[model samples]
Target: MTRRPATPLPPLEERRRLREAGSLTPDQLAARLGVAIGTVRAWESGRTTPRGRNREAYAKLLAALAESPTRTGAPGSAPAGGPEEPDAAVVAVGPAKTVSGGRRGRAAAKPSAFTQTPPPSSPFLPFLPFSPFSPRVPSWAPPEEEDPLGPVSDLTPVQAFDALYSFCAPSLVRQAYLLTGRRGLARESVERAFQLAWERWPEVARDPDPAGWVRAAAHEWALSPWHRFRPRHRRPEPPLSDASDRALLKVVLRLPPSYRRALLLHDGVGLGLPDTAAETEASTPATAGRLLHARRAIAARLPELSDPRVLHRRLAELASTEPLRTAGPPAARDGCERRARFWTRFALAFVAVLLGTTALSLRTPPAGHEPSVPPGETVRDVPPRVAPGPLSEKQRKLRAKLREELLHGPERLAPQPR
Candidate 1:
């Protein structure tokens, strides 16, 4: 295969050719190239041409598309540069079939564990119409039917966690960018949050507020094992349009850890005094006071944030750049189930042991239940006046007199209070 010379077609023609090839949509190409959708549109409209690095990137995109047959409509043929497709073979995915119980027989092919059915094509793409993936959603917005499961209303807790993240991840990423000022840090935290949420989906889904849980998880993740104890720089956001906002964020990143935490817990998470305090394990009043001071300090350094419009705009911008990392909670419900099974087995064994011991004890007669008492021993309910010890001579004489009197048919005694 011969490599073609770099064809510097006019911007409009180049964009048209890329679109005609059916390799990628303008938006997909733009995203892959890290350029704005509008930029692609402008190029297609002959409004502009890519220069330097962008030109190289565009060339690479075209080359990749040319090499990938499926991406570029090669009609059931392998890509130009890729290896040949393997011969067809049965791909089993379900339980293996067995013939007879008494005699061994051939096992049937089974379905694979990893196969996923792609969603059917529809005009709708989950949430919104134009930009299927955009930020700034109402906190209580529900998911759409176009999603893999059709709707979130019927989804299980684990599924809910995933659906919500797919919808909310973009905004969360943007928020990170706004709060941290470092785009990379913002991306890292949001991705970490998504990954962790996926890992503990069962528990998180069971939670009343899974998204909030992910938010908190992400916030803490930024200060991970590598950077937990490090002195963090503050990221101050100035007015959205003001270029100075970037510079101001650098200063915010320099704040002391406590001050930064207080400010971020309040502003970044939109947490109130009580919630922020609870998350930080501080008193509500203390948290409020600290937040007030932190905000004041940030304002003192970056006065632009004091403007309400600027602050709101910056927040909105941050909300748009949510970083998406590994998606979904890790599937670990099996671990929980195993633990539950262990406890259940242990309890059953313990109960059996206890019952066995009880039965053995019941089989033996209690010493106290014996009919006869040993010599010199006394039973609790026996009358004290009926002394078992050696009787005094007077008592013995009285006893003998009583017996004689009884024999004579008359005997009298004074009553005592005892």
Candidate 2:
């Protein structure tokens, strides 16, 4: 039986807008969604649309992107310099119609007002007009005559690390801060996570959820025991201008790590349930339960905030606070130092394995001295025999008698007598 294809999602412009709001290039968006870069481009160009799970994931991602503070500014405000009336273009979701004129007429009809402008604070200022997240032109195109986008595909290890670090450092630190109440501990965790990511950039760059991967690592490091021994210099806490928000933060910190992490990722970061599950390495249902439990626990503690909406708003406000220390890309370690650390760990592991093998070998019995066999089992050991010499007369007589008994059965001789 033939099946009808799913309806294509809302127009390419919507997808492009969401991508901009999320501050993600097509490649980065594809990586996050576990889709190919071509697929994201196709969707944005209205060449094709996502379906089934992909479609659902795309919707959730757009919703999450819309809510993210980094891209969308404050909760109620539109993105900086975004269109005042987004609904007017809702009718343009279907395939684009061919214009009645040649290329010149089409170019003339294009609205320059809607053209993307690069953010003033962007570090890659020289390449601002060719920004990957810009919807006006494909990011894969050459930026200039001399500086082609070839290097993007063949980025050096340091460049890749820097790109990932610049995009995600602040968000990672914020997540770490939520996991561990202390800003110092949070910074330590985030730095450690970025350092590890730098070491494994090749693998991480190809990961479907690079940000989530780093966030998970940061969470684990924040909860690690190694930090307990380090001297802590606590920064002054953000003033509790509102007592209710302060109280909520206290309650959130007291929850179990699982509950707290689930809650923070869902309500605090505006991640969908599946994304939260992926970050926490839990099943969707399990993550949902954790979130439910966390909300209930918080509500129980403060009856006034029992409404789900109120609790969620409070959590978002708490999570939006700036970290005590600003986060940046982790400094690249010297190749010599990295190699030394690797060899040191490898040698220690090798020595431990050798010791274990030796201990096991000593506990085993030597060949030919194994334990006794159980009943009905036979041992087949053949002892070495000495070379024979000439037989003695008595030995010869005994051998002749045994031959005679064998030739004429002893039973036949005894029967004849009976």
Candidate 3:
């Protein structure tokens, strides 16, 4: 195949505008150009520019978008002027598949993790829209009918949560696994993250990227420094079955956590550098540096995996092929509810105990102002209680004489009284 000549693409901001003005989403453009959505996002975010054939195709697509009549604003967005990104106009457009009917125009983009909800229910993944694949990607029971990505109000909160869970959990588990080699740790991370999302569903549902919100939580938990101390995760899980896969993962694990994370988000998970950096809590440049370092390390060990696309496929494989399969959405939701109930009961019990203690103290307070004994005191003037020692023989003889002279004593006693 002949390589397309280098084409001068529009300015980065213009690229974003071109797509937005055309009512196109990242996934739409990705599908059209035969590239991963992250590649398109990277192009728009100015992290990495397209090259060779891709550059040519992108330039052509943008030129077509420029020529196409501009709509007032993209679907699901305010007309003309509205809040957009820092350097670009705000236009939210969903997957172009909404136009499958050829009438509704572009539907608003589906919520993120829509990676299989970031914590899909199993190891054998049913890759969501975000999964990297050719336009002809296959999965079981395409959700076109149920439309899990439909408007928030279309489904009850429970249904919506379950939808998010079913879609995102499996992918999230895989992602968490790649982040931390321990399979159980990965499952736990996704479970904990989803549980947290349920606790803050209000905030999460309103978020621009709810799946990403859970993804961030899961990844953070999986990569936490504290996990090393856990008895279950003290040592890494056994390596992957394939020798090549094991080698690739070994290289991945060898990198610093930050660098490994950047690599996973950017190359492994097909996220834009900006997203990767934001999720990893690093500056864009810093994220880029980490990604670069990570890629170089991988390349040094395994040359064939240098290409971002290949690396992504390998990472996905490594993550998905694990023996661990997570629980379903119902299970996740139930776990969340269970945990909430337990904590609620615990709090109520604690409050009741505290109140009871307070009431008991109030009911039986000190009756009187009972004097409290000081710590150190001794009586000074108190006499000894024992009578004087037995009188000598002289005292005994005098007592006998007094008894004999009782008559005379009466006169003496009477004189004394007078």
Candidate 4:
């Protein structure tokens, strides 16, 4: 009797499904079979079919893997491959014999910890209605529910400000301190600038350089005269054993604010010339000049500090003397709320003034004109003006004939019926 031929194994897709059922990635399968990743990819993509020895080995590997039990069960525990049985029991039968079946069986079969079902909602917690307007949910929460306010990438004003504040506050305070030479004043300036930022957050957050806006505001506030009245607390100058370093600091403090700001923002804060110019509100060329002049001034005062390395070190030392003071998140939030309220009131008042002016303008009559008639009303027509000159002979004859026709009818003026 002739031996029955073996049925041809399933296609590459079926093979891939078997591999996936065995919890293996394509790369893992390729490595185990000692073939290039591209070869596996080609097989899966149907670009090329495995042949000869490769095909035979691949078929056997898939069959063995399909029959092998997953990590959740003992070897050869799973039934031979066919359509997955819905009621298959997924018993975790180690020391603990928990018999989870049905839909839970599939979830229990997964080896990955991430696939575990979450615990049921706590009974003690009150059931709160889900608000569409709620703020962002935590990262660990299931993502089945859609967010009404959209993704976090389109950040709200408060979130944007908070992110900016956390990122830039320390650097801004240090930059401000270098400008003002007073640590307390620097902190105050930075805080006030952040407050302004929070007020205009809708605009600032959308700017290409939110940090630049804050830096500019801090620069302006640090130089303002209001700080003078606030009781001055003299911070002890950090000891400079080298006379040249002390002299350098003195010269930097003495230079014009523009030059000083340019130097500190560029050299000290490590911002580029264009960013410095933006923060200083000057053209790039002007900013370059300020930096040039500042360098020349420092060089002239202390030639030893002219070297870039020395300058950088000296600036670092100076800035390092005072630690940056970051405002608490709560304080920042309160300031933002306060500024928001102020702007809200100001906007309403401005709108009110505009509306009142419009109403009054509508009510007042136009100059050199009486009250205009309503659109639907009709006015009597004016009589046409008579010509000033006396009537000519033709006009006189026409007028006499018209009067004769009016008095004796047309037949009397028509040479009678004849």
On TM-score, the leading prediction is 3
Kindly provide the TM-score of model 1 when superposed on the true structure, using C-alpha atoms. 0.37
RMSD (CA, Å), candidate 2 to true, equals 18.5
Q: Model 2 segments beyond 4 Å from truth?
A: 1-154, 225-242, 307-309, 330-418
lDDT of 3 at 154: 40
Best by lDDT: 3
Candidate 4's clash total is 0
Tens digit of lDDT per residue, candidate 1, span 1-418?
A: 5333232432222234445455366678789889987677555533345666776777666666556655322456545575332211111111223323311111122211111111224222232211222312211123232232233234355444445555455555554554455556766687767666656766665554455666667667664546544455344323444455445556556665555666665554334455667667789788878777766776788786775324433433333323334334332334445656888999999999999999999998677865787678555522358658888887778677666755654457789897
Q: What is the TM-score of each candidate against the true structure?
A: 0.37, 0.49, 0.56, 0.43
Per-residue error (Å), model 4, residue 66: 46
Candidate 3 residue-wise lDDT, 103-204, digit = tens: 122111222211332323532133222211111112112334333222223446676677677667767777777777777888899899988888888888
Instruction: Report how far off residue 84 is in candidate 2 (Å).
Output: 14
lDDT of 3 at 124: 19
Q: What do the candidate models score in CA lDDT, each in turn? A: 0.50, 0.59, 0.65, 0.59
Return the candidate ranking by lDDT, descending: 3, 4, 2, 1
Give candidate 4 regions above 4 Å deviation.
1-156, 225-246, 339-418
Question: What does candidate 2's lDDT look like per residue over 1-418, in tens digits?
Answer: 5343332333344566567555576689998889987687656643454767887788778777766765532354455564222221211121122334533223223321111222335433222222222212222233433333224444465655665556456556656776776767777777777777767766776664565667778888887767657655344555555576567778888898889889877765545576678778899999999999998898889987677545544443354443345455534344424765999999999999999999999999677867897778553432234478877687678667777766654555344554
